[model samples]
Target chain A: MDAMPKWADVVLIPLISLILAAILSALVILAIGESPTKALMLMIDGALGSTYGWGYTLYYATNFIFTGLAVSIAFHARMFNIGGEGQAMIGGLGVALVCLFIPWPHWSLALLGGTIAAALFGAAWAAIPAFLQAKRGSHIVITTIMFNFIAAALLNYLLIGALKPKGSMEPATGKFPEATHLPNMHEVLAPFGIEFSKAAPANISFFVAILACFAVWALIWRTKLGYEIRAFGHSESAAKYAGISPTKIIMVSMLISGGLAGMMAINNVQGEAERLVLNAVEGAGFIGIAVALMGRSHPFGVFLAAILFGFLYQGGAELALWTKIPREMIVVIQALVILFTGALDNMVRMPLERMFLAAKRRNKGAA
Target chain B: MELLTILQVLDSTMRLATPLLLACLAGLYSERAGIFDIGLEGKMLAAAFLSAAVAYTTGSAWIGLLAGIAASLGLSAIHGLASITFRGNQLISGVAINFLAAGLTVVVSQSWFGQGGRTPQLAGSARFEPITLPFAEALRDIPVLGPIYYELISGHTALVYIALLLVPVTWWVLYSTRFGLRMRAVGENPAAVDTAGVSVVGLRYAAVIICGVLCGIAGAYLATALQAGFVKDMSAGRGYIALAALIFAKWRPWYALYACLLFGFLQALALRPDVIEGVLGFKVNGQLLDVLPYILTVIILAGFVGKAIPPRAGGEPYVKER
Candidate 1:
């Protein structure tokens, strides 16, 4: 028997944590001499007021969905895969290569090629750390963190050398060919007698991200592999006794996690940028950690959390534009969110559980 | 390579190794007491920014060092609140601290200085100038040994020597003292320490606070001694590399010094790509050298080299069974 009901565990806790984070963020704004109420109004208006704002919000959400699902998959296996940033960077490289070299005759075909390439490249980057962790008892957290730096260095070298376009001053590939352009919201909604902002970057990848959420849901709750992964996570010794191979679970889940993280490229690099730049990932990979923690590593929960972060990203930009607040304000808010939801969770949970238990005892006495 | 060229690289190696050594020792103290800290980078970053910001404003590097230590101590207290008092996820707490420092430093800098999140270039007494050891000029004409001593060992800021000095002090404290024994026991078997009537929480907090102080010094060295002022994310990934060095050293103080120096040498070599090409007759990418520490750490971790085992109670929060 639990002290609190399931709904409260899932919904109430997160709400309280979010409220705490918001209160602190408000204090921060006040410290900077800004009006928290005005900031809140502006955030809501810029992020959810109209189709134009929704487009940008959803576009950022697409990136978070892939990365969040990626982190969530690894979390289920009890593996801390902090290298999502590097994997996404390499995934962008894969997208760039597929689009630039394949010369696809149609956008659909190019999307297919890009997806496969991104997943494979991302999986390859994750494989080394996974292998080391499984075979040698190496700490996955440390190994993955190391991989992030190595991947960055590798990407830097490539950007400066082979990846840069001829005579280009920027350390980025040339603009992708027109044939590989993904359809934005405006084009997709027009045939249905609906309107969307044409300037918005939200594209077909948004649907793919939704599909991924469902797929991840099924994979975690309805598969033998998922069971084994969770079993290993709960108790490695017990899982071994139950005939589950830790190595297989570790390798499979990390590869999938890396693949999902890599697949974020479809939205950012292929769908939005249309050309691979040096900073394509833009810290969205690290944002996955906060999302997975807040969502409790559930796919549907991740979907909601991703959107929340998307709103924060777009609204933060709006705040920067309309007020004196700097763009890094969003990062401060993110830190508070992660701190409250992930690290100090018990700070909320302990008190909530006691209150619920007290209320339950009162009802029993009354009965 | 020529002797002069090699000497120069070694000199740079000493300078580069100081921060790694300081940060690695910070990790050693914290993890030794069973509190795993992945936030050394963040604490160092916060310290670096505060140290630079204060130094630039006040024009005294000494005051900057104190401010830096205070800043790092504040973050350490937060980590203690979350992981020690609340028994939350240590790694998660660490990640949060990293992000907090990364974000808060920039926001504060932008609000305070308004130079796009940067402090003004420190000058005069605000920065640590390289010191000329006594008799260095007199010793410079003796021989190869003289040049090496005068050029490589005598020209670093005082912080470098302080970092090197701490290595032996750390060894003596960890091996030769009663508090050191209790700290080590707390990390490996907190139950035993508890049964013996020592306060596990107190020892762990002390270790964490020590870690913070070392990290503060490391950041101060980076901004005030090595560079004129702080740049955003100027510590780069040195905190992570220092963590790697901790593992590579197998949690021993002397081995940590060696690991840091080797990693620092690699960084020094990476900065001079021409030296590799001139000596080895082939061009090598500086990025590869930049990545070598992480790669080598991975390989060592995989046990392809010697095994690097952490302390048994390293990442687990100690719980009283009663």
Candidate 2:
């Protein structure tokens, strides 16, 4: 009884939305008196042309992967965990605390410690809003948003007062010990005789991000909890009739979502920054929303969407450096993608469904 | 501890609260009419930039206000098109608008001004100037009432008075007129209103446009009246605080004013922590006050302090059943 095939539903729709967004983005660049074709060439050359560009792109992709998964899981549960920003920021704090206070003998142990701390802190941050949403009737969207501001204030205080290193005027912690320094892509790939840009921040965390994709794919498709979560999302009343606990589903999904989001701290704060910075998460948390939307909340789809966004981000930086195009161009592109894919989805979908139905009727008549 | 210091803090609170009050009221109309808009921040940010840019270019504050309203209305139209016409996710549409403004304003401002996403400083006639009440100097000798009139109420810009004046007007419109009754009813039960032969779409759009106008004024006040120029991301979190205030007020008009003022007082206290430090006999952390409104709102949200129930049909796009 579906209007179109599953492949078209999953792939074709997002593709069309992306193309429409790209066209609008080209017009926006043109409106600012820049050549769209030239900008495209620059983006390709900057993001995908060399190993260096790939290194930076993959680094950003790592951060996006974690966040995108966080958002994807929550989207499956039909809960908007907009507090990814806060959770990720708190995850950075956890990473900072673990790195600065704990003495690890090797990077492997440190990574494990940081990862555990990040997930726990991130999950704990999400738990409060999840608790309220489950027990009380408070909207998760508003509560998560309020939490973002609170997280920012909390970070601002800790960075200035307690976590700050002596003689450093900046609101950031001191660097982690050399024992905890992560190996870059260059080092990680050296054994295979492959060269990567050493200057780039792409590191072992990128592999972790890839593993997370597989894990999320398996978890969402293969697990009993996933069944309950999806069933609850599809119909709360039906799920309740089937004996699924709504409160448990809400809490468990949010905790996993928050944990995935927190894993981004391992990539950005631990892998890249080395020392936790005030603007550690930046707007990557919000970008996760667009990634999840465009990906249709599928892990494999999320991986591709994250790569596309990472390319836009790194390419936009290149445009800022070389041309008159501002870096906010990527943001505009992200917004357009979200608009076309998420909000105005039916605008594109309704027409496509009619065309498909007509084709199906024609094929049946010919048979 | 001193009377003058307390009066000064209260004075600062009035200025800080103006933007929050206007935005809270803006949210009031939209949520009351069954269209949830988290894009108020985005609208305010856009309006702030456009208003500052226009005022700087035309050297007229009024023209800037108009331009700001125009920008906000444009965004509102997009929201209406997506949510009302296409029946898309309202929250998704709102998130898009927010990102749109956050990015577009910076792009446009950087290209137009070349001041790195900032408008040029607006001077006299380009910005709102404070208006002194009549005979304020004549009453300066009076002990308590003189300072209250002169320091607290008399020296605000036109928008402050406009914001204060809108409270009662809003209350009257929400409770009095036929349009007001339809607006409230559309939010609560659009089907009921539709059954009563009212166009639910028309009423919702009207509510959205009203929301846009209020956000426009709120942004204009932030840039032209309060700061005298627009910087990138200058709207900051006032939009979110206004949202918290809206929830705190339970979507009523008068309570919005009180909530905004209370939040604004916290803002004022954060700005000058010495006043708090002197009283507490210890240095109070600035971050705590900055985080207070959010925590308080969360408490209200959790039903620990008070209950805040939203409009029944809020956040759901209305579809006519065949």
Candidate 3:
């Protein structure tokens, strides 16, 4: 009975969440004095209406996917990795430094070096709090939050003072050398009659994101380490009794989480833009939590959820152009999705489980 | 010669520390009742925006202060309901509330005031003026003690005085009052508190609401007293700093007060490069100074202050079963 219910949980849970999101969106649209039908139509059209729109959506979705996976990786170990913002910032800094200061003859080598540098920086940043939590028992939430502030200050200082581009008032680093940028695939797509605008900076990052999803899926599902991580997440005491070190597992989980977050810089620096700018992450790390939650902390779930979020983001911007609504409404909608999904998870879990159990029992009786 | 300059810095520190002190104390109450009040930042932001807006409209600082407290109380009520009644995850709910407040305050401020993410600038009459004490002025004629009193106690904002007064009051309430005992009990073990005939939900709600009120006042102080208006994200992670202070102070009110003051001093020191240069007698990178408090917070949390243990049942919601 339990086994059947657990199996059904995978399918039914997300369906219920979507329905709940729709109802919640309706209520929000009504409250804000908009027609729900028209608003949602606008949302769908803006997200998927044109080739360019879809490309832009996919471009942003790629970053969301990486960050979402980063967050989900930590959640698997029952850790709330709020350091995603800090990790991403530090990683971007590393990428920018490598691209600008280090001389690379080949674009591919520079890109690879920049991405690896970001991952290492992010890993080091996360390792501090992990060490604190493991060695000193400091709360991960508070420590990570503190690191976020430090990262912000550090990024601001570096951008403004050390890495500021010549003749620019904005707080941003110098552009990467031509060799460091990812080869733009937009032109390649154009030969096939796909019109890729400069505004749509879609590149190979989307493929990288998909590959990351598969990698994480395999890491969590196929490996012995994944089993230990799941076991630890289920019950720390049980895992401890089974000879797993909680401290080591926590440190490893946080390191991986941070490293994945660092990979986000590759999308931003190499794929999307050539410069390191302030607010480059732009709350992506924080929004990753909502994405992870909506995805139910699963790899494929995170992928689909990232695309959904990317749609809302691009669509929200487009909707702003057509309506009086501000772009910030997208943020409100995102928050609303998180609220509804979180609440619906509890509301639907038991009823669906009961229904699945009853069907399983009936089938067994007939057999 | 430099000793006097240090004293002046200390004086400036007290004034800078007042709002954070109030906020940390506010967080202390909620956390002691087993509710994670990460929404302190949101509460403060809402209060700051409302206070500034109301003060500008009404032309009364007192009214603005009251309005700020009322605004914060309303937000706290939402937090209390979600966490206590619905048994939601305290941290996530708090984050949602924070993000909501961050976006909502800016949206409303932009729409209502048209000031581009801020309230209108408040006049002196609509702001909390510093209070000057005659005794302290008279004492300044004396030696070192007189300088200490004159510098630290004189010409500070009214909220600073209120914050100082709250320390003993908080101690009294937390240690002596039956309500405080029950609140602590609920934090330590909600089940035990529930079995002891106390309503855990009610106590937690009350604690959170009080936290809201305190955060509101702190917010108002930021807008009306500390500065003159609200800016987008003006709280600027001060709420988290206050939470760090709460832990650093071991969750005790007086200790929390000191912790807030220390952080506030760091902030003031970071802001004034001239003073830092004068004191250190060398060139200091301005960015390093700016990042000092955050680095200190990380260090403190890591091991500097040793382990700051939270209540055993801190983030758990109470559910009564027969």
Candidate 4:
């Protein structure tokens, strides 16, 4: 057997799988009595046409970037932290508390306060599952999944009982103080004489998400901690022999992952909603698994995958609003993409690898 | 607690535990054959929707049951194909199935019923009725045994009995039957089973198919016996709960019964928090009650109560290496 080239493995496989998923999605749309091509056009236009579209897309991308990076970091440690959903929910609680109680003179200082609070809350949520996996031999997947439900229940209890505004029927907290409000893209860009969409929710958190990508890239590829994490993931016994404590590595990687996931609260809660909503996470944590898989668990890959999903989410909303297509259809489309890219990946890879290997053999014979 | 109150709680426990028992047993078969099936929720959801739709259309609960079983088996086949034939990652395949079922159930429900991801309510014979035992009335006056027979056991739907019966059957088959030995061996060491000339793929597919059938019954019970119609996302994380119960049971059939009942008891308490608070004279938060099962699941997974050892090859796809 011959190995696939780096370019083909990294680029070609996912590209083809994505195309396959797109075709299947088109077929589903057509079956629902809609024009597939027209749907595609609407999706592109609604998600990427102008500053408004880009604003929503970037806002969603920001959320995905945090979650996708969280999943990718854990994947490097051979851990599946499905509790990102729960961690983010708790992180939102942290942000809400910070914005509610503390009096910040400026948004910058508030942002710093909210970030630390969110990270600590999220890491605390993840620490239990990490400890279980390391010391108790419990499966991280099961424990983390259970934590997601528990987190939802906890958030629900808090919002309705302790966090709700006075005499409000809705299960949400009061808006943050005006000083805690983050500047949106329109406000940020206007100073440079650049016009942007005012109503768009994309804020300074988008830049923070981008910065996170760079930080994650450096941490994974250029740092000793990253090397140890990857080494432990690749071979647990080998890492143990090399004096890398599984308990320490698991705890640290999961804490970092949880913190990153928690940081997504700054984008959705402080930046967009300006309040803690019940469903602030909105399934981004689950979508992060698909993004991480599609991106090959690399920082750059996760960034691109995040944008694509952000487009799907914003575009899917447009489809539901404008057409007969149900909002559930987007979930179907997303599932197909995940199915092809993550589960049935070998269906595409095996054939491509064979073709590449055949070509290499013929070239060698000719030489 | 009064004796009557105890009987009522036990009765509610029976009703609540039915679906969990069925799904947990379903998982037992599949996991014992080295196939990890986290898609039980998806299969149950699919079955619940299909059964309700069919029952509404045909006006026959039996036909609905058959339809639900067939739909569940179809999903199991897909899981088997991905994990067994294509040798894909079992967890990823299970997750995809879950997503597929969630989306497909809603899409199909909207298209078929035009009721916005819900089925029309089944009335009269289209819904399951509690079966009265031959001597239930006469046995109702026997003091200690009266409430036990009439209230706690006798007046439930037929599916509950079937689920209870499956426990012993599952135990017998896994320990006493030839195919059961092969299935266990395949889970523990597929290479050894292969060397013995027993087809690993065949045994696994059989296990998955059985899982599908049981999950189908579980779903049908929820839609028809418990509720009169199917609602979107109706499974509501029950499959994951069942998987947790399976872990808590340590993959044994008899223990699966107790684990499901314990969970069911918790659910019954959570459902009627007012009754519990009145009896215990302590106000309980409904949301905290809801979180108990999940928190317990995590505790069990962490081996706080007892260690859980998974089948050696549970998540691995069987590949014959030369």
lDDT of 3 at A186: 74
- Candidate 4 contains a number of clashing pairs equal to 0
| lDDT pick, better of 2 and 4 | 2
DockQ of each: 0.82, 0.81, 0.39, 0.71
Ranked candidates (DockQ, high to low): 1, 2, 4, 3
Clashing pairs in 1: none
Off by over 4 Å in 1: none
lDDT of 1: 0.92
Counted clashes in each candidate structure:
0, 0, 0, 0
Interface RMSD per candidate (angstroms): 0.8, 0.9, 2.4, 1.2
Measured against the true structure, the TM-scores of the candidates, in listed sequence, are: 0.98, 0.99, 0.91, 0.97
Runs of candidate 2 with Cα error greater than 4 angstroms are none
Candidate 4 accuracy as lDDT: 0.90
TM-score (0 to 1) of chain B for each candidate: 0.99, 0.98, 0.94, 0.97
- The complex in candidate 2 yields a DockQ of 0.81
Fnat, 2 decimals, each candidate: 0.81, 0.76, 0.33, 0.63
Model 1 chain A lowest lDDT segment of ten: A151-160
